[model samples]
Target: MSSLREKLKTLEELQQIDLDSNEVRAELETLPAKRAEIDQRVAEARRAYDEEKSRVEGNERERRQLESLLAMERDKVKKWEGRLGEIRTPREYAALSREIDIAKKTNDGQSEQIKALVASAGELQKTLEGKADALAEREEANEAELKGLEERQAAAQQRLAELDARRAEAVKRVDPGLLSKYENIKRRRAGVAVAQVIGMTCDGCHRHIPPQLAITLQRANSIETCPNCHRIIYAAEAVNPPAPPPA
Candidate 1:
């Protein structure tokens, strides 16, 4: 009786260690998703910065073209003005004056456009600088956050290694056939191969155990399995014995 009791006790301890190991494994599983989420934010920030840079460059190109066109118009108006003194007839002078007037008007329009472009360039550059700052800040903060997550991953890995080592020791204490049975049951029952009987109910499957089986489990002379869940079942009072009625 004592030997069987000790074996069940060892199995229970092993189950607890396995459960802890499973918890650590689950934690490890989420690390990649966390990393992916961080990467996504960094990507988004980079894209925003790039878009702003593109806009600023495009605006600069537009400004340069407008200035070049404005300069050409000014040169045409100056050449037309130099012809003012050489006009020998009223008809030629009038036509040349009309050409000069039209050229000056074109120049005025181009100048306004250049002014608007220059004003927008300053604003665009400010937006570009703002985007750069945002990207930099996000990268810095996210890098730190990622580093912290890496540290947590390492710690969890170390913890799982310790738990696995303890589990190996626990496995050595259980009977081989019983341990094999437990493993088979665990594979089919979501990694739970043992359960306590709570009020004649199998805590594993939440199903009722037979009256006689419940009684047999309470005696705990040998290992027992729940018919419904197929899990190794024990009555709590049988193995731990309720502290011997408060001493």
Candidate 2:
């Protein structure tokens, strides 16, 4: 039969497995939030791009409307000039001439405005193109990062499964009462039931143990709980002594 020291060592191994499982579980719980953060960034980038596109489209619609209005004004000026020679009186001719002049000025102003808009359209198109490229780049980068996160999550899940299986098997090696005591302490001590005794200190809580208890723990004849933290403490010297120096 294995000594008590061997049993306690096995329990510590199980504790290590459980601790690893805890870390993986923590990562699994937060993986979705990490993914959500990436999704949010993508959504924001898309929204910004859409807003810029809408503004450009609005400018185009306005330009078209102005062009249509200018066409009508030019047609009016042409019709009035054609009637200038057919006027019945000087006053009528003067009125028609004034109307034609006003319409020509309006047409000239509309043409100038349209030319400016067309020039600026090139710049706006360039801006739009730049934004699109940036959005696409962001999407690619975000997708790659998201993929990496997914792979990590999958690996952690697989590791947790393996650790859990190890824990289940390891539990079988301990005495039933000891296992029950360990479970009880694990629940109350934040998932750490066993702590190693290094020197005179409890590794779990970093508190000093009594000199007598520390000496007793080193003997490996029995298992004891830390007086201050109440975690099961064992001496590593009993199970994992230092290697002898080569002659």
Pairs clashing within candidate 2: none
Local distance difference test, each candidate? 0.89, 0.88
Off by over 4 Å in 2: 243-247
- Candidate 1 overall Cα lDDT vs. reference? 0.89
Off by over 4 Å in 1: 87-95, 244-247
Scored by Cα lDDT, where does model 2 land? 0.88
What value does the lDDT take at residue 17 in candidate 1? 86
Please give the clash total of every predicted structure, in order: 0, 0
Tens digits of per-residue lDDT, candidate 1, 22-105, equal: 998999999999999988998999999999899889988988998888888888889889989989999999999999998888
Mind sharing the TM-score for model 1? Answer: 0.90
